[model samples]
Target: MSELDAAVAAALSADGHLADLLPGYAPRPEQQEMAAAVADVINQEETLVVEAGTGTGKTLAYLLPALLAGRRTIISTGTRTLQDQLFHRDLPLARQAVNRPVRTALLKGRGNYLCLYRMERTLESGRLENRALADGLQQVRAWSGRTRSGDLAEAPAAASEPALVPRITSTADNCLGQECPLYSECFLMEARRRAQEAEVVVINHHLLMADWALREGGFGEVLPQADVYILDEAHQLPETAARFFGLSVSSRQLFDLARDIRLEQQREAGDAPGLSEQAARLERATADLRLVLGDGMRTAWRTLERPVGEAAEALAHALAEGIAALAPQAPRGKGLESCHRRANSLYQDLQRFLAEPDEGGQVGWVETRGQGFYLRLTPLDVSEQMAGQRARHGRAWVLTSATLAVDGQFGHFLERLGLDDARTLALDSPFDYPNHALLYLPASLPEPSHPDFAEAYLQEAQTVLEASRGRAFLLFTSHRALQTAADWLARRGHHQLLVQGAAPQQQLLDRFREAGDAVLLGTQSFWEGVDVRGPALSCVMIDRLPFGSPADPVLQARMEWMREQGRNPFATYQLPEAVIGLRQGVGRLIRDASDRGVLMLGDVRLVQRGYGRQFLHSLPPMPLTRDPAQVRAFFADQSSTSS
Candidate 1:
């Protein structure tokens, strides 16, 4: 072996933190090859698209080379859990194994930190002014005394209460910047300063996209100019990038700012003119929205009614005039400035949408979320835009995941990301999936659109639940389907049923764990990144394939975008997306080499439709069975062998 290869081999063989970090527990041949491939890309400064399978040890594959290359690199993940794992666990162990003087820092979005300015504003308001909350704020004040890293996650929490989160959390748009008295010792600023010096900076997709949007543009310059970016869970890239790329504003956010302004005026003893009137105007806007939207709270398209087709035009015009008038009259505080900026941006976006149609222009709707409303005007084609960004950035990019391709082709994903000439490779897992998992597709189920499909699926799901004794998750495509299953299973009352909204996610998972033989039914969020090892999770019942809601304004626009580019949206875009999502859902089962579970895809399309084979090919190699009796028999055989 050459010098670098020998060094890598030595690191691979060295003893480290976990007993699992050695050659005996080394990466399989394909995984080792993947590591070498990534190293080649890092050295050459070329983009690479790698589809490393579930057990490929992709984290170490990228980390070892990133450290070895000694290039300032950024690793972006799809979720916060993986971000924590890389920073707290994997990266540290990799540094030890390599024995390299690699400096690393974990950086999250500004919203993840407690903005002292916003916190003070919140404290002044009765929102967090209670004695218990006052005590919590005091703790943060004390923590600020010693914390070198401004990461709020690092700030000590005496209690893990959800209410305490908002009291201490702040976002960049709402931050006071360098104007505030506490700006010198701000946690958000301090964290960014540390990140400037770190070799490997860990961030999430949302933050990375925010960096591109110039929203958190300040921190990007602080980060060391990088030679490579490794995006894990890269499948979430398109959607997440779209969200940040678009514009958003909300009535709730304006109202919150109004409330904050009222508190600030009282605390600062300022004779601020027009402050009261602006607050009242914001409240009026919020009340108008609430009255128009009515009491409906369903995420479904049929349930939501947008004020469109002339009424929308009129509303858009009125909002534009109102926002323009309110801008000059708004108070000069950071809070009011942010609210005004957001309102003006949102109004302009609405006016643009009202004036334009989907023919060549992008079409979408606006809706209110927690503290804000989003008015998205997505581009008909993002491929060109994404490709342009990748080409402009002088860095080698590695996008890896188990489900980046469908039917052994990266064309769908590559086309979406505009990676036409990028190097692409796939690595297979070493696990013997045929012995580990059984793909159970019930032959008698109706189509997903059938009125009775959910009920029928739930009926069959109960049978599988009984076979596995409730150590399963019934994942639904929609909230309605999930509730239907939860309600049905609740009525059965045989096993402990934990629904998604019934409690906190961690608490529900805890119940599922402690109850041992209970079922936890959830929607899209539960499909991926949920690791329930051993018998606590033995079966995965998928109600149907997760497809983008056809009625969704964004999805419709994307479909039109694909069509405009001379591609069949269903074949090129929608199907491939569904295949990847289904794999992620099924991947929750059989997490380890010794793990065994049954994956029941309640969607009959996997057996009845011609496109079903694509999904099967994308999944891990497993025994495909239609006979329910055989499913039970296989479970019995596995049980007997273990005994």
Candidate 2:
């Protein structure tokens, strides 16, 4: 091994640097192996994909190498929660262990920061809709006066009202940049400046994608300067990249534009008669488009019926006319010019969204949320685009996640990420899964499509909950199923049922933990990123395999495209996706070496179907059982052992 590799190995050793510095630290072979792999990737400047299972200390493994190499490293996480945790917790600890003063900056999307200009405008406009929002704004005003970072997460009142964050933050479309009076003190700009100068930068996948796509100016250029790019929760990259590479225009965006134009006209045009009328026309046109799309409808744009397409085309024409009416007034002032630019941009985006062809590799879809509608053009495959991006950057890339591999193979992830030549490493979690966990696949349950499957699944879940004393997470593939099971469980009064959407996800999790032995029912969101250790979460019941819904516009388009290419969509796309999701769900069972629990898969297909072995193999090694008596015995054994 090289000197650098030896140093990394020693740092990860039992009595090495981290152990000596970190309180209550215990070294593990998996973490050491992952650290060595990361160090090699940094030294060689090669791409590496690693599946460091839960409890492997993957964050520290990657951070140590980056700090030791003293290179500009950009670490991107899947969620802001993880981003904050890394910047505030993991990075500080690693810095302490390494005994190096590495400059680190946490940069989230612009929406997370307070925009003094926007905040002032919002307050001055007297547009506060309610007392709560008004109070939140006042709180933010106070925070803005004192905050050095201007991050909304640090403002308690702003954090309480999530809907108000967007109103107070500046987006790319609306930011006045250097022309604005507040440019000197702009929070987002300062954050970007710090990031550019820092040795390590922490960001979420959204910002990373925006940077890769080169969506903005100065800030978008941060990634190309980094020597190493470490992506935690790497599984989310493919989906996030697809979004960033796509085109989208929303009804809300149009409404916001119209509102801004009116405000600007009042400031610049000084009672501009034609402009106000045109703005109103645009708002009405947007509402008409929303009505045409209707609520809860998601369908491929090419597959939309004639009337809907015609309505969309008509709305696009109205937007064009509105932009034309506003264009001649652009020379008036900065505010009016901003509005004109925004209007023209929105109109062009609408045209592109409506006219863009799928071309066999893209999926064009329209979806409606509440009263708003969105037209989206998403790439069916982002691999080639991502590969082109990687080649252009020529930086050392390290991708790590607990659920990146299937059946100990990285082929699925590597192919999706366009990292065919990347070195691969799979580290089994240090947790004693076989001894501490049991994989309970219930037998004789009806197929998921059967009319009686819901009752049968609920019955089996209740059995598991009974055996585990109501400490369980009942995970369903759809909200409909979650609601059905939640309603059934509530009526039966079997356990303390905490349903998703009853409150915010965090609140639900807090309640679940506090209840100690409650049963929590949730859908896709609960399948991953949820950590509830100890005996409080003794069982996890999955209703069915988490296959992407065939009715979903994006999934349907991708599957159809794969079929046109003579590929088995089920094997190539669907199965692997389901396996990864299942792994995430099952991983919630064993959080630590001492944690013991039962993972109950309610789908009978696991034993009756041939593909069952793939799902079983993808999970952590654990003793399998079909009989409920075995589940009871496992819990009993756990109780006796703990006693």
lDDT on C-alpha atoms for all candidate structures = 0.73, 0.85
- Candidate 2 overall lDDT versus native: 0.85
lDDT by residue for model 2 (1-643), tens: 9877887877787788787876887788788888888899888989999998888989888988888888888899989888998899999988887877989999998888888988887777777679888888888888788999988878875555856766788777788888988999999989999998898999999998887776332344644377888999999899999998888888877887787777778767875778888888888888887877777988888887787877877778877877788778888877678777887888788787777757648878888987888889898898898888777764799998999887888888999879988999999888888888888887878989899999988888877877788989999899899989888989998657899999888889898989988999989888888889888898988999999988898999888888988999999899999999999888888887778998988888888899988998988889999888999999899788878
1-643 per-residue lDDT for model 1 (tens digits): 5455555555554343223555456436776778788887876788899998777888888888788877789999988778988899989988876776998889888767766676666556655646787787778767766767656666766323455665566555455677677888787777777788888999988877777767233444434457788999988888887676655544545555556545554554256545555556656665565455544232322234565334444545544554554466456455556556655655665566555534454555655544344444555556776787677665788999877889899988897788898899989776678888898998888999999887788778877877787788888888888887777877888658889989868789988989988888889889887878877888998888888888677777677767877979898878998998998898788777777889999888887889988988888889888888888887787678778
Using all chains and alpha carbons, the TM-scores for the candidates as numbered come to 0.89, 0.97
| Superposed Cα deviation of residue 4, candidate 2 (Å) | 1.5
Show pairs that collide, candidate 1: 250-373
**Could you give me the TM-score of model 2 versus the true structure?**
0.97
Q: What are the clash counts of all predictions, listed in order?
A: 1, 0
Point out the worst 10-residue segment of candidate 2 by lDDT. Answer: 215-224
Off by over 4 Å in 1: 1-6, 13-24, 125-150, 154-167, 215-222, 267-269, 295-361, 368-373
